[model samples]
Target chain A: MRKIYFLFASLLAGNFLFSQATPPPADDNSLSMANTQGLLRTQLTLTPSWMMKGTSGNDSTSISSARTNVYLHGTLEYYWTEHFSTRGDIYYFLNKNSAPGGLKKNHSLQVGCSYHFMKGMSLDPYVGVCGGISLVQISPMDFMKGDSTFLPNYQVPSHLDPVWAPRVGMNFYGQHVFHFFVEAQYLMGTYRPAIGPILSINEIRISAGLGFNFVILHKEATVRPAI
Target chain B: MPYSYYFSKLIDPNPMKKILVFAFLLVGISAFAQDRKPNKNVGGQFSLGVRSTISLFSDAGSSMGTGAGGQFRIRLYNFMNTEWFGDYLMSSIGTIGTRTDYHIGWSVMFYSPKQKPFKKYHPKPYFLTGHCFDYTRIAGNNPFYQDPNHSVASRWSSAVQAGLGFHIPFCERVDLSLSAQYMFHLGKDITAVTRTAVNGDEFLYIDKEEASINGHLLISFSLNIRCADLWHDHQKKGGARKAAPDPDGQNPKHIEQ
Candidate 1:
């Protein structure tokens, strides 16, 4: 019994000694001093967006007149430096209107750059301006000649309008590969159809979702940690 | 790189979404490109790629059309190039009418003198002019119309287009281009006009217009990859080595830790 106990203690001591000599594997989540150069981030989410008041560009002043639109939003961003990044976003419309003469489609693509506030922290806040195009179409509304008579559908054309937006967002990085982001964008545009009144495409959109971070070009870890 | 937990969650439920994500992921992974230094001496190169286009402001009503096509480029000089392309486009006319177009054309591209040669990250502006042979068909959505001849109309015509475009090269071998051109068709105009009946019903009528010239705008976006060098310019090969100075301003072999 005494010999067996001695053997077990010796084995335990040897294992502990060997473990200290070997360095632990590098953790991806472990904060370091390396610069965030050439990092690529991608995200996709379904966002429910509301068109703000006065979207019709008409005399109507009601704030809640327009309907809510849902879009499949996809984003691709690249960090050129620690504080500046280029981003492109695509919003695909995904709603079928009930009324014959309502918004048929509202799709947009925007590209811009953002200035990130936090340098090395897991949480980052940013502000940006983007310019792009919006493809919009409105179905022909029913023309009523009498109290009950309905006329045939009149076709209104689609317009690809130039749009610009200002955006503010926040990103919270997870322990390793994931990050959560939420952003608010105020877009402005006007759609000019061949026939009919000009329509305003101004709206406020908000989206929150998860994203993946990838480092395409790794930099040297030479800077000393602040702590 | 480790796969994010959120990615797996987002991709787990829908197989279609999985395919979409995978397709984008492949594009992201293949973003790596060879570093081609700016060659001042080389005048010729070759590239091939696919492009997508949006046709707008057509005379055949207000509906916009989306199209996909492919193009190949042959650079004869540092400032001159040529592109050959083919495109098939389809658009809806009003509510129940449709228009289909097939175009095959070639364009001569002249690089602007102000552009920096072989700079990958900068935008290089160019002017292009081209001519194309096209076939257009306009048809009514209704099959059992009263007039069979009025239901469908088609024409074969030729068009000329001129546009200003810019190329943004991401790497030595890959570039993205965007251009907007005004295409004028020289053929019989097939026009769709909306008319209202005495009963307050509105309908579309398809007929040939009195005018002979048709015009529209074409916007194109393309991604191209350099594949070959058709001609070997010895001076350009030598200039490349001299052009790329050391980023660190030190001999790479003699750098100290």
Candidate 2:
């Protein structure tokens, strides 16, 4: 455990040094890790996505149903390079699925890298993949045709399943710090249990939204002198 | 009277009491002085922030739940600030199911000076300690775990947390912060969730004991919207303080905007 902690500390320290050593990019077009003026490398995106499939009864899962959902998706992406960077995102279904007499609310978090194609163009297209956790909460199990022994208090039960997604998107950079993006992705695996045969449910999501990115240069080590 | 004497007076019999006294003293002493910047940093001003905390309960070694919270920070001086925050989170512990938590807490933050520590160039670091009122409820009755005779209910307890972290300025209006705090909840430990047998035939038989202490390691990320400095620059323009000229104020060490 001590060795592991030491290694982790070393890695973090190294990252800090590297970040400080790398100066902010002068040109706004090229990607730099540091957030600076015109280099608003971090982008926050909000999109209302139309899901191809939602919770429907007997849709490959006993506890799940099939329907269509229009939900809001938000993402924050940081581009470390003109074509590459890291992204973390969280999304939730706006309306709950009432397939099994319970509210089927779904939310997920994912982290991955994106590769942008055509660096200098006004429209930059990218593809990416990420793996994270997806949680499905269903409850009021009085509807389950099983013994009341497992859930004495017909309450909400949550399942956390491993999830993954592959995304392809195009970004339209405009005159200012804000831009527009449209993305399509297919998500794999849901923690929801299947009644008879298959393991879980996977989903496909497509969305378009606007984002704002700001780059802040590092403060020099020296303190500011009082005028 | 020498300021050191007042500092000595703040060192009280109880450690918690000492911290409280020290906090008040720092705030009072800095309130009357106008040497610091008028509005650039977390000095003598208030900032609002959204705090997201991932709390990992000791019962579930690797499992963690997330909380969305907001905080108000008041910078008393260059080195001290006070924060008040509240958060709510839901976590699934093993098979026992979901556990929901609501915590309201306050912390005193002590900032490190401008000098970089460990030779690693990073944002400013602060040491924090505070107390919280935590209310936790089990989402449902764990057929295998809950007390058969007792009602499935919620528990409220007092907790104290301490940790260290960084405050990174993203821009004039925004600051990004990251911190890891260890919190010990002093309350009756309820069976969070239960583990199920692979065959689903029998409830896993194990030692079900009474636990009174619950601990969690919280990692939080926050984006703070800092306000302007409390004091105006014109306060120094009166020229009264310049007449007394700070004896050792040649090149100030900590330049805070």
Model 1 lDDT tens row, A1-227: 35545655886897698678534436654633344556777899988877765433224332223678888999998776667676789999888474766778789987666778888766789997666667888776554455653445756677666566789999876543667999999876655454434445678888899988776765343122333
Candidate 1 stretches with Cα past 4 Å from truth are A1-26, A32-36, A51-65, A71-176, A184-205, A219-227, B1-76, B84-104, B112-123, B133-156, B168-180, B209-211, B217-257
lDDT tens digits by residue: candidate 2, A69-134: 545676777554455555677877677755444446667776655677765455778897665666
Flag regions of model 2 displaced more than 4 Å.
Answer: A1-68, A72-98, A101-142, A145-171, A175-179, A183-206, A209-227, B1-42, B60-62, B114-121, B139-151, B192-211, B231-257
lDDT per residue, candidate 1, B110-216, as tens digits? 88543243444578788999999888877664322425566567898899999999887655665678899999999888877666557654445678765487888
> What does fnat come to for each candidate?
0.00, 0.02
**Tens-digit lDDT track for model 2 on B1-257?**
99979966764334555557766886776666755432322356678876666778776322466556678888776678888998866554332334567899999998765422221123778899999999876533324434433324467889999999887654444456789999998886665333454545322122223547778889877656656556432335533322222224553332342
| Lowest lDDT block of 10, candidate 1 chain B | B248-257
lDDT values, one for every candidate: 0.68, 0.58
